[model samples]
Target: MAYVLWEFTILGFDPTSFMFSGALIAFSWLLVNNRMMDTEALGRDQLFYATHDPVILMDAAGRFAGANLAARDLFGDEIPEHGGSLRQLNKIGPMLDCLAATGELNPAESISVGDRVYDPRALPIASPIQRRNNLLGWTVSLVDITERERSAEALREALSRAEAANRAKSEFLAVVSHELRTPMTSLKGSLDLMFNGVAGDVSDRMKELLGIARRNSVRLQKLIDDILDLQKLDLNTLNFELQDVEPTEFLREVMRDCEMHAAQAKVRLSVVSDDAEGRMHVDPYRLKQVVGNVLSNAVKFSPEGGNIECSLGATGDALRMSIRDSGPGIPENAEDKVFGRFNQVDSSSTRASGGSGLGMHIAKILIERMGGAISYQSRLGVGSVFHIDIPLAGGVPRQSSPPCDSVPGDGEGVPAFGEVRG
Candidate 1:
């Protein structure tokens, strides 16, 4: 075999003898690999310093090694220089200790520097080479969140103001309703006396005029009463006298009371109580108001000659009452808003239907307060069904004490619409 020879210098000193060409080529490849590794390390350092977020590097001994321009601006002259211990730095030392113990990249911690809020995070750096896989320290960063905190504080204040305004409005309505009811009661009585010819015999024209006045006065009185009830509900002062009563007979009586009004609307009212006989513990007068409000709506909305059905049934442990009316169904968009205060399915219908738009809302509130729920299903042009579900008296635990010998009043001493006789 032909002998191969190599010539090289060792650290600027000439070699004493020639070396094999294969050994020379191998040494050249090692130098090239080491140079490439150095270039990669330099590139990584450049990227770390270029980042806009404050980046700080620390040694495994918890001493500061380096920091980017952003870190200098954030910490100002307080930034540790050279191999200074991080424990000596104010505000930053404790945060660094927590990060070191937890080894978390982003901890739920914030630091307030002057008027600014900065969210601090730390990530441990490690050697990339497998053989040198050693802890290199940490890279800490800080993110500003001052604007976010300000926005959150503003939202809290706005909610507080809104709640205060609503309370004030409810109080104003309660006072005004009480003030108006006194005059309305007197006006209604006076008009009724005139219509019944209590003053004197009247001509047909005078009687018709007095009858109109009587009806309008009655409507106004009802509106005022509804407003007062709504105000009481808002203030959480509405009282209930729970009593055990027959559901079928009670529902029949309510239907019967609405018959005269339904007749005037030319709508036929029907009740179907199929095997629904049971005693329900409920406040009878409040129950009546709930049923009456629904029944009245059914009468008002039902087309002439259309039939309105009231159904009562016992399903499982609950008593369910449903009122089905043959009227223009509620629009899809307005369905969810029906139980909102002063909400109406058809705004123009309020005038024709003779309502203050509080009937359904009040009914819902009363039902809910009595531990029940009300919902409805409606199809456009096909009519609607309103359902109330109340747990049977003993089926669910009572939420409050039974009506005492002295019933709690709403401070106004207003008489509710039910007989108190047991």
Candidate 2:
């Protein structure tokens, strides 16, 4: 006897009624043939046939036994006849062979049908009997991933374009900075000479105007230098002369250089080197520039009579340098913005302080390029502390030390330094 396994419900027949008749026919056939029925497998087959994603069932012989509505839609109305070899279907034969050999789907393999891309997966159906746990057939599911693949391709293209644009922008900035430097240097020198009475003695009013011009010209010159440095860094063209340097001597030099600025701000500068034996491998000039930038910022923000402390110590194959400033601390929300280019904690405050908002960003880039890391800790009412950690030369292990506090001279009293103003 022959029975219809599936009928189109669109053809004026209720799907529930057709399913009931099909089930009754299957049950009667099993009883008449004196064969045992697997109700669990039958229920699973019914559910599989109702799935929205295309599902195909193949018997142990690799012949198509059944397909779902989605599968019929995918393959067209003329699906493979019952017991027909699945190899006849396009791009499905190799996947079936892979599944038969490995008993699992190859996720990396995919099939393209028309404009859609599908990743095929296979699962073996085992016999229900405990003693005979053998493979009865296989269930293949095709998951369409065309949209996902397209989205990934689009993202890769966008990333490539963004990188190209960044390279172009960096190159443009480098060229523009070089062109502006020559004229700016000449203008600044002329202004400086006039202000200093080198060009000729002038009236008090004229001297005051020249002084303003000189100061602003100097500020502009500094901004141009910073832009050039940033561009060089971006292009990886900045040169470094790496050498072993003693931390104690290095800290002393940096502290000496910072004293002028600290004095100008009425902020005392002091250094404490607890572990002075460690040597750092870095470009002294570049490292000093990084340190100077941090010191300048500290001095700029620090209130009069407040102290700026520089400390150096060793911790596990790395040398740590921290700058502590008694200033209005960085706000919680503005902490992260400090390292971003042209970003300031408060634009109005930074403008009044005469900064281009690039000092901290440049310092961060310089430290990172020298194989060091820069970070800071701050509180709203207290003060701010910036730390730089650089690995020691020759990878020598550092001597164990107590955790460095965020505040320099936390327990130690601030030492006195004689007045040294710029």
Candidate 3:
């Protein structure tokens, strides 16, 4: 029994047999895990092959590890089988260099890959290694951007055609305005001579009739001027003369000039200033023209015995000017079209308003030219307020006197005949 026990111990302690048994068990486990791994890898490879976009895997040194079937389609059989630089794939050298330098690339940037614009994306793959292992490599995705390129080219062509059409329209309007003004100038000159008694002495009733003709002629001249101004603004040819002017005084003067016209229309005009003294840097004439246009429109649209108020002040960094009128206010749905050329808010009211449907349009252009903006708010019956917003410099009013008036017609501040020519 002692001998049998010793032999059993020897069998149990056999080093060579124990080593062989352990090796066999490890080999079996490895075989099972390898089969499972191969199945997962095969599934990923099949999916990658079926994808339309080109996808590639690379090692840390920028050597290609693998590529999808879509890549094979783009590069044909010329693609290297294994361990080749992505730069060797085609004209992707610069893009590869950029990706390697920047560590990441956005998809919007275009890259050239073998005569085709490719939008490539580079994203890092996380490693299974612990403690935040160094970046092992990246997966690059390539999208054909040729369609985007074609669309952009088409848009550019459309823009060019639109610009050409606008130029043609502006040229036609400019020529017509010049031609119309020539004949109107001659007629106006003849009428002026007759009304001023240069032709002969006329009766009071005849004089009144001539005055009506002359006034209508002047109105026609104003329409032509507004049209020409619109053309200039459209063509970006309006010469800007910027200067510093006192804001309060400027508002006061604009109100003073329009006093007569407002009175004639039986509308009460008032001016409100937020500052006893304030100033701004802008083109004085154009600024006044913008204010005058707004005030005149307010007075014209207001009913008899209605109130028109002009207010000037500063709101934050912007200077604000508002003209409020009491009348049948703007139509709710027509507000957006009010600033468009030839868009009449109230078609039936235009004949009485005596406008060429260009006042607000011209005012908008003038204000924008001076680095300002104008907007309006109106209810159906309460009133309408036209607001002008201009960038402010914020300085004390200068001690300089106001500029002398260059030329004038009626106290309504319409330009004189010679002033209208230019």
Candidate 4:
């Protein structure tokens, strides 16, 4: 018993119907060709012919044997009753010849025939009359993929444009930060001098006005720095200087560094626990940035006369530093989003919101890059605690990353990177 060739269906066709029709087409081909087909065999042939795509049949020698009605309409006048080779078809002929040579009856690369693109599939069938007829023949279908290809190209173009725009924005922010920072620094310095009677004795009103100006300038400076740092993070240009640091001391220094901010907010800051004993292998400057970011959030949100507690504890080869704030706690299902840039939180009257939103996101990424994790726990009305955990390997260096252009600080307060001396 001779069966029809197995044809593969791709996009634009129902796979089940395609397989069912293909199975029937196998027996239909034998009956139709041998001139013994009934109405059922003719029905199967009609179903294959009615397929939306153009399809053709070729003998083992690459000669055109048959074609569906759709194929006849698509390749009009190119196919005759079966005398020409598949190589005679426009654009597809050479590809079909290559497929025949390699005996690859699978789907190959797409091709453009005339005005549209098509994904082509081939199916090879065995012949019993091998001596007189060809040893094998193929049933090939050309599925139109013009719309899909166009859509893919448009998506790629849009993504390229978006990436270009982001890069331009980063570049613009970098230039603005550099140009504005120097002048802003000088302006703040002048205000500080006037307030301190460097030029002349200042009156109380002048002193107060100068102090306000200094504060606003400081806020702007911080915003600019956050933007610049965020850009560096976007470009993966933020450097790290790994060092051995006592975890408990690190947390204590961060609390001290944040004391002024807490004082300004009228919130008392305290270290609740210092159970972490060993040193951690980490970039102290970057880690400080992370801790400072979380602590800053605590200070900003704490209620007047509220207490902000910092704690460091040991947890099975890892050190956990948590900052708790006595303020309106974060809402439920907000844990993941707290680190998101410009993330929306419970913005009621009790919560005092501040910061550029970039700091938290930058801190999260930086902490994770240093082989650490940042997370939080909160009660709706009680308070919230932000946790930072880093694995401790007993002072062993954990990174093979290239040396950063920064040197470690003397574990003082919240440390800043110093330039590496040549």
Ten residues in a row with the worst lDDT in model 3?
A: 413-422
Candidate 4 residue 220 Cα shift, in angstroms, is: 1.1
- Measured with C-alpha atoms, the lDDT of residue 262 in candidate 2 is 79
lDDT string for model 4 (268-328, tens) is 9887667656777789988988999889888887789988877776544567776777777
What lDDT score belongs to each candidate, Candidate 1 first?
Answer: 0.74, 0.78, 0.74, 0.75
* Tens-digit per-residue lDDT, 204-290, candidate 3: 998999999998998899799888888988888888788767777888899999998899899998774445245677888888888
lDDT of 4: 0.75
Query: Candidate 4, TM-score vs. the true structure?
Result: 0.74
Please identify which of the two predictions, 3 or 4, would achieve the higher TM-score against the true structure. 4
Q: What is the TM-score of each candidate against the true structure?
A: 0.74, 0.77, 0.70, 0.74
Error of 4 at 13 (Å): 60
Deviating ranges (above 4 Å) for candidate 1? 1-53, 102-107, 130-135, 235-243, 330-334, 349-351, 379-382, 396-422
Clashing residue pairs, candidate 4? 4-26
Residue 194, candidate 2: how far off, in angstroms?
2.4
- Name the better of 2 and 4 by TM-score: 2
Candidate 1 local lDDT, residue 157? 94
- Per-residue lDDT tens digits for candidate 1, residues 59-111, read 76677888988778777777777788676555677667666665653346787
Measured with C-alpha atoms, the lDDT of residue 95 in candidate 1 is 67
